[model samples]
Target: VGRDKLLRTLQYFSRFYAWYLFRTNRPQTAIAPFESIKKQFGLTRKILRIGKFIEHFKAAAVAFDNKAPVDPILRCLAVGRQLGYAGYMSYDTITVIHALGIKKLANPKKMQENAYRAWLASLVCSAIAGVYSLWKLHQREKLVDRTEGEGAVELKKIQKYVFSMQERAAARVQLISDLFDLPIPLSGVGIVPLDDGIVGLSGTVSSLLGIWSAWKKTA
Candidate 1:
């Protein structure tokens, strides 16, 4: 995961830098290198992501069996988020096969379009889940009583409160990352008029966030 995030960071930064060089009227010789780097990293990431759909599919299956007394709406959103990501990854796997020339596709462009559409749906589900998680966290926080006198019960409440705050912080970061990522797919599906510069920079920001989160998990 860390390696993938690193590649993604480099890929998007290369794209943004190439756009910058062109926009600044740099010589083609100067801009070509970064463009090449961008393409290489993008292809490498696609290869690395092969067969990743199974992971998301497994997660969706696990979510489907969740019997916890959480809100039904949140549970449904969780399942939807996983399924959306599974669809994205499955479509992406096909694109990678086409990219590698393992099999010629009749309409490579349409395959790419479908992959982007799946990715857009996944991001939408993720963004919505993040928002809903934060709202639920806020409601949970309100129910914690901070004014209780010192006792075992008070200590437990304090601990729970701290944990809830940490969860809220994580949720906020994810929400911001999802928002940054939304423009890429929006532009991919022609829902937005963003140029490469805008999309690349947005992707760079979200990639950095992914790196940070992955680093934390590893540490």
Candidate 2:
């Protein structure tokens, strides 16, 4: 709960910062958790796969824009699942759709373009973050890590591995959030798969507009 609160605070503040800095309609709520979650998972493997998914989706969106439509449904599903694997990856298409915006970004598309490297680095960083988080947790509760030589070494190694390259990931969460606009903190959303590979997002995001608005926009 404390962690979640801290993340939310960061996200809210980051959005303020992004708006102050970027002036785009995008939000950063979904970015930090998404990247963190992706790192938590196979940071290297899954991210690369998701990056490919984004690339394919971008190509398809362009083709569709040109009246040569290919299905973005599968790509949406893949993104959805990938987001889901991330701890805070929500199932709501409203917030989830923000992810698409980031994936399609051209200028700062490092996460998508260099999918493999970003993924690997993220995983490395996440592992580091995890260790420190654990250490903090252990400090709060002595049973978490003993203070013996081997224990100290284990703790030290985890700290070194994480902090050493952490600078690289400094903007990780913000980058992803800005990239995808996935951090809207929408209230209600759910998915229901229908026949013929069609899926529906059901719920509300903001104002009185729930999934209905999302449907209208997508429709």
Candidate 3:
């Protein structure tokens, strides 16, 4: 994940830089360097993502088991999110093969469009899940009752409060990342009118968030 995030950050930055050059009427010679970097990193990321659908597929299966005592709606959202990601990865894997000339797809554009749609669905599910989780946390916060506890009870309450805060913070970060990512897929699928510059910058922001999250986990 860390490697992919780093590559993604560079890829999107290249994309944005290339667009910036073009928008400012810079010579094609000026834009070509970043354009090449963007294409190369994009292909490399696609290669790295190959076969990743299996992971998300397993996650979907686990979510379907419903072993956790999570809220019903959140559970459903989790399953949908995993399934959507699995679908996106599956389609994207094929596109990668076509991209590398290992296989010639008859309709590469259509395949990419489908992949983007699946990704958009996944992000939407994630965003909704984040909002619902935040709402649930808020309800729990109201019931925490920090005033009526003593000694061990007070410590327990304090621990729970801290955990809830952590969960809330994580949810907010994920929601922001999803929001930034939404524009990329939306533009890819022609659902929204966004130029390459906007899409590229949005992708860069989302990639940086992914990097930060991965770094925190490692640290």
Candidate 4:
């Protein structure tokens, strides 16, 4: 009789224990099955957030808008924090970081446009120098009494093509400047022939100067 009572008592507790464990697992059960999904979404949102942080990089890659870049940067930071500290800096999180770094050059509001303008202008000047040098070479060839025949004409034609390329290349620099709101004029740019027959180039020095000003202010 005592043994039977003891058995009933133990059985009763076991039933109660099982019920407790089951009832308490309501929230826990849902978690194990959905963890992967939660992480995937969390990470995707994080990546997109980072994209906004580096809007300038996007502008550089794509000539989208040049308005305020700060808005996007803030968005990225907010999303990143929501993703939690641990997940915010994961492997793919690096995508946002790299994009941000690469796009840093596109911030025209910080006078970045001037900087690009300067670089493009310098390129234009260098190209002009190259073409003038080649033309001078061609002219010297024609003046030479040695083999001033078919070779000279062919050289002149090749040099003309080269000049065309330089002209086109220089024109692109202006386009780059225009994108940044600093207009550049192709006029007043000239190349002088040096004593050693080498070519020297000079143009508006202000493009680079303006670029320097932008940098100093940015700093």
Candidate 5:
């Protein structure tokens, strides 16, 4: 529980720092997109009447003017997300280590009880983090969609910022996915999956070692 709390604290700090930078370093005066397709083409009516596609691209070309890019925010987000994942990995590794130590206890039940509590606490914290990640991703997606819908003029002004957030979000999501789905390459012919399966296997091996230690004590 202590270790997980420490990791969680680190993750929160990373996010706080990112948000601080994002707010303080925000770019100046930006224009929103101009939605004209509904007014000129009346997309639904045109499609219903002619059963054909409307030339919205031409309309967009005529309306858009801004071409400048917005300040980038990906680096801030990338740093935070990577730190957060590092915390998670550390937490998981410690949890497995604790599980492996279970067999070394003379009174295994007491240690098991504490381990279960720690596991439960970590699980709850992990669930909260996962929810927050999902929520943040959803918010970023909305930002991307809003910017894109506004057309190129508005998009051009803030496209880079939105894309940066998107790229970071994609990378974070990929990292989380890869944690469970990908394999770790340590050296030649030393590839192994870095998922819960490995954690379980490692914990079991540790427990067996602990048993051996206890048997030696008895002997």
Candidate 6:
């Protein structure tokens, strides 16, 4: 009778343990479905945010307006070119005076003064050009990035305009090349053959003349 009682008790304990395990596992099994739903919800939100961002960029691009007449990059390049020419002229003037042994022709201090002017001018021009070039380069990069995000149509328009400008610039460069090729005397003195110094001086004169003419036109 005791053995039978013990067997019955062991069977009862086993059944109770199985029921407890099942009860404990039910919540964990249900959590998997909730986790899947959460993952799907987060993915959908991210996609929506990205779509909104792209639409905002497109709207802004459609309303883009740059009404200013003057292009800063072109003006900066022009100024840098003029300054480079002027710097070259200053340096060359010293070289010419020294080479011709004209120190004795003028006051001894004149040579020193000219040398100082040349180095100072060259240094200033170089520093300004370096800084402006770097700044303008970065600005162009930003402009390109902004344009690219606009859309295909805007990018095409930009490309077309850039090509047209390039053609115009090429023609201007060719004209300059032809003009420089012509034989021209450097100075009224008739002794200094047309050299790089003279070319630099001519560039300075031409740039100044263009600026003066533009000013007059505006006035």
lDDT for each of the candidates?
0.87, 0.34, 0.93, 0.37, 0.37, 0.42
Question: Residue 1 CA error for candidate 5 (Å)?
Answer: 19
Give the Cα-based TM-score of candidate 5 against the true structure: 0.27
lDDT per residue as tens, model 5, 4-75: 223323333333343444456643221111112212222222223231112222322322432445222432
Weakest lDDT window of 10 consecutive positions for candidate 2: 196-205
Query: What is the Å distance of residue 64 in model 6 from its true position?
Result: 31
Q: On residues 1-219, what C-alpha lDDT tens digit does candidate 1 reach at each position? A: 889989888899888999999999999999999999999999999899999999999998888888778677777877888888888788888888888999988988787777778878878878888998999888877878645556788888889899999899888989899899998888887888898899899999999999988777678
Off by over 4 Å in 2: 1-113, 143-219
Give one digit per residue, the lDDT tens place, for model 6 in 99-123: 4465434453454344344334433
lDDT of 2 at 28: 63
- Candidate 4 runs further than 4 Å off: 1-108, 145-219
lDDT, candidate 5, at 55 = 28
Lowest summed-lDDT stretch of 10 residues in model 3?
142-151
Best by lDDT: 3
Winning model by TM-score: 3
Per-residue alpha-carbon lDDT of candidate 2 for residues 96-207, written as tens digits (9 for 90 to 100): 2335453333333333333323323333333344444445444534532344356558887566545634533433432332222221212111122221111101101111
Candidate 5 local accuracy as lDDT?
0.37
Q: Put the candidates in TM-score order, highest first.
A: 3, 1, 6, 5, 4, 2
Cα deviation at 113, candidate 6, in Å, is 4.0
Residue 170, model 2: Cα distance from true site in angstroms: 22
